[model samples]
Target: MLIPSELVLSILSYCDGSTLATCQQVCRHWQTLIDHYDALVWSPCCERDFQKGLRRRFWSLDFPDPQMVDAAMLSSYAKPSTLWQSLYRITKHWSLGQCTTSFLTNYTLRQQKRRPCVVVGTTQEYNFFTSLSVAQSGHIVRSNPMYKGTTEGRQAMIVHASFDQDPTLSSFYLEDDALHGIVCHYSHPASPWIVTGGLDGTVSLWNEPERCVARTWQGHRGRVLCVSMNDQVVISGGSDSMIRVWDLDDAEQRGSIDISSYLSERHDWFQGVGEIALNGHLIVCAPDTSGPVLIFSLLTGSLVYELKTEPQDVAFTRLCLTPFYLLTKGEINPSNRNQVPIYPNTSSSSTPTVSSSPYSNTTNSGSSSLSSLSSLSSSTSTAISTYALAPPPSLSLTPYQLSRYYNLSSNNMTTFTAARSCIDVWDLQTGKLVYRLVPPLPATTTASITDIRISPNAAHVFACVEIRDNGSRRNELCYWDFSNHHTAAPSIMVLPSMTSSSFGNAWACFY
Candidate 1:
C-alpha cells in the first residue's frame, strides 16, 4: 500500500527538521517528495525555532560570523527554503558561540597608524563614551560627555560614525534648555531619528540627517529616565512616575500613563519608570518599585496586564518585551541581600574556584513548565547563618531614592550588595514565570551588571558585567544563548578581560 503524495507531504509538514531528514533517507520516493515540498515542510520549523519568524526576517547580513558573508547574499534573493536554512545556520552559530574578531589598522597616516579611530569623545578632554546605539544600517551613534573649564565646554554631543565610505565620523551637539547632557537615548532600527531624554525633564527628537533637534517635548516635571521612539510616536519615562506619549508628526499630546495611579498601596516608596520597550501595539514598562510590572495599550492607554512578582522578588529595574514573552531583571530581596554569597574572579587563574554555596536561590513552580537552573553547586543555606547579617542598605533609603542614586552614580552601582541581579523570563500569554536565569558567574564573585541587551528575537541576552575581586576589578561581556532549548542548559560565555575604566563607560544595543 502506498500513501498519496499529497498526504505524504502533509504528514511530513507536521514532522520536525530532524524527523524529516530521517524520513528522507527511508526511500527514494520520500526523498523526492520532501525535496519538492521543502518550503511547505520547513517554514513551520523555521518559525518554531526562530521566534515565530521574526529572527529570520531581521537576521543581520553583517553578522560577526565570517561564514555568514556568503550566506548573507543568498538569503536576500533566495527561495523561502534557502532563506530559512541560512537563518538556521546563523542561529546555530550563535548557539555554539562561534565567531571571529578583527581590528582595523591604518599604516599610511601617522595619526591613525595603530588604531583605526577613537571610539569615544571628539575632543581629548572628555574622551569617554557614556551611551551608544548601533543601527541596522551599520551606523554607530554614541553620546560623548564634554566638560571643559568654561561653560561652553560643559556640553554633550552625539557622535555619528558611518562606515559606508571611508569610515567617516561627525559630531552633532544637541542643544538642551538646561544645557545638561543627555541622560538616556534610543536609536530605532526603522527610524533615523535619535530620541534623547535629559536632566531638564524634556525629551528631544533629533533628525539625524539634518543634525538638529527637530522638536522637544516637555511633559514630565522631573528628569527623564528612558526614551524610545519610532516614526509615529515618541515614548518617554521620567522620574515623575509618568510614561508620556507624544505625536511624532505634530508633537501633539497623545496620552500618558501615571504609574502611581495603578499602585493600590499609595506608598511614597514608588519610583518612576525604570525602563520601557515598545512594539507597534503595546508598551511594556517596569517602574522602579516592587509593586508590579505594568503593560499598557499604546493606542487606548488602557491597562492591559500587570505581572506581579513574589514578595521575595524586589523591584524590577530593567525589562524588555516582545509579543509573547517579557524579559525582566529585579533586585534581590533586601532582607536576603547580604545573605547572598560572593564569588571571586576566577577567569585569570588556571583553576576556576567553585564556591561551596550557590549564588542565588532557584525554585521551580509546579504549575509552570519552566525550571530554574542553578549554575553552581553547594549549600549556601548554612553559610548565611555563619556570618552576621547586616541591615540592608535600602532600609534607610526609599525605592525612589535608590533609583535616583543609581541613575546619578558614575559606576551605576547598587547600594545593596546584590540588587537586580537575576534575569526573569515570563510568558505573556500565561503570565507564569518561564525561567529564572542567574548569570553563570562564580557563585561568590562580587559582580554588578552595567548594561544588558536582548536580541531582536529574544533568543539571546548579552550583559556587560563588572566583577570586583581581591581589590582588583575587570569587565566581562557575558552572554547566554537560548536558541536551542533541547540542550540541557543555555550556552554561557564570558569574554576575556577588559579594563574597568573603558568598559564602565561602554554601552551595548541589539539592532
Candidate 2:
C-alpha cells in the first residue's frame, strides 16, 4: 500500500528524530518523501529538539524564535540534502555542552597595560565590574559600582555578542539624579528594561537598548541589597529591613513589608536583608544572619513558609529562585566554634593534609606552606614545620562524590543550597534532600566557597572559591556538571589575583 506524500509527512511529524531516522531506512521511497517535505517534517522536529535540549542543558527555554532559527538553518544549509543534517548537528552540539570559552582579552589587556584612568575631578578610578546579566537578545549587560558622575571610568556597559554581528561594547549611563552606587541589578527575560538598585535607596529602571532611564523610584529608606522583577512588578529589599513591591508601569510603591518584625523574631538586628529572589508566584528573602529563609506569595505579599537549615547556627546569605525551587547559601555561625565539623585526612602522606570541612579556617601562620605545593621552601619552611606539628587532616565524605550516588532524574526542579562546606540538593516537589556535594580541597590548600551560582538550565553549578596559602590569596572559579553523575572533579578556572581582589561585591551568571 502506498501513502500520500502529505499524509506520510504529517505522520512523520509526530515521530521523533530517532523514529524518523529508523523509518527513513525502511525504503528509498520513504527517504525521497522525507527529502521532498524536509521543512514540513524537520521544522517541527528542529524546534522541539532545540527547545528540549536547551531546557535540559541550560535550564532555560529562552532561545531565539522558531522563524529566526529556521532562517539561520536555511542560510547555513541551502542544499536540501544537508538541511536536517545541519539542524541536527547544531542541536546535538548544544545538547553536548560543546561550547568554546572566549575571554574578554581586549578588556583585560586594556586594564592591565594601560595606566590608571582618571575620572570626575581627578578621582583615579579604574573600570570595576560588579555584576553581569545576559539579555534574551544575547547581549551582556555589566554594572559597575562607581557613581554616575564618574564619566572617565567604564561605569555600565552593554556588549552585543549575537551570532549575526561582531561583538561590540557600548557604554550605558544614567542621568544626574539617577547616578548612585548600583549595588544590585536585574533584567527581565521578556522585556528590554533593566532595574537597578543603589546604596542611595533608589531603584531606577533603564531601557537597556536605548541607554536611557525610564523611571526612578525612591522607595527604600536605606541601601538596597537586592532587587527582583517580573512582567508586572519589581520587588526590592533594603538595609532598612523592608521588602517593597512596586508597579512596573507607574513606578509607584504598591505594598511594603516591614521585615523588621521578621528580623526581631530571629534576634538578627545586625544582619538586615541580604538577598531577595522572586520566581513566578513566590518571593524568598534571606537575612545576613542565621534567620530562616522567608517565602512569600508574590501577588498578595503573605508569608508562605520558612525554610531552615539543618544546623540552626548556619545562617543563610545568598539565594537563587526558580519557578518551583529555592536555593540558598548558609554560613556557619562565627560565634559558635563547636558547630564546625572536623574531617579526617584520607591521604597516605602524613605531611600533606586535606580538610573536607567547608568551614575549616586557616590562620596566617599556616597559610604560607600550604599556598602552593611547589613553593615549599623560604618563608614556607617554618610554616610547614608548624603544619607537621599540628593535628592530622580530618576525613569526611566529599560532597561532590556523594551527589553521584543519587538516582534522581533531572526532570523535576531541584534546589541547591551551599551551606558551610557542603552543597545540599533538594527536590522541590517533595522537599527531600537529593544530594550533598562537598568539594575536595587540595592537600596544600585551604579553601572556602565565596559564592555559588547554578546555571539557568540547572545542568551545572559554578562556585567561586577563595584559596589562602602562606598568607597569599587566590580566587578560583569551579564548574561542576550536574548532568553527568559519574564525573568526579570539577573543572577549575583560575581568575587573575588582581581582578579578583577588586571584586569585593560581585555577581556571576551563565548565559
Query: Which candidate's lDDT is highest?
Result: 1
lDDT of 1 at 293: 80
Please estimate how well model 1 matches the true structure, expressed as its whole-model Cα lDDT: 0.50
Query: All candidates' lDDT scores?
Result: 0.50, 0.48
Clashes of 1: 5
Q: What is the lDDT of residue 4 in candidate 1?
A: 95
Q: How close is candidate 1 to the true structure, as a TM-score?
A: 0.60
Kindly list the per-residue Cα lDDT of model 2 for residues 367-485, writing each as its tens digit.
Answer: 21122322111111011110101111111112221232132213321311111343444333334333333344544445555555654434345555555568665445544442222
The worst-scoring run of ten residues by lDDT in candidate 1 lies at: 367-376
lDDT for predicted candidate 2 compared with the true structure: 0.48
Estimate, for each residue in 278-337, the C-alpha lDDT of model 1 and write its tens digit: 766667787765567887878788887788765423456556664355667543445543
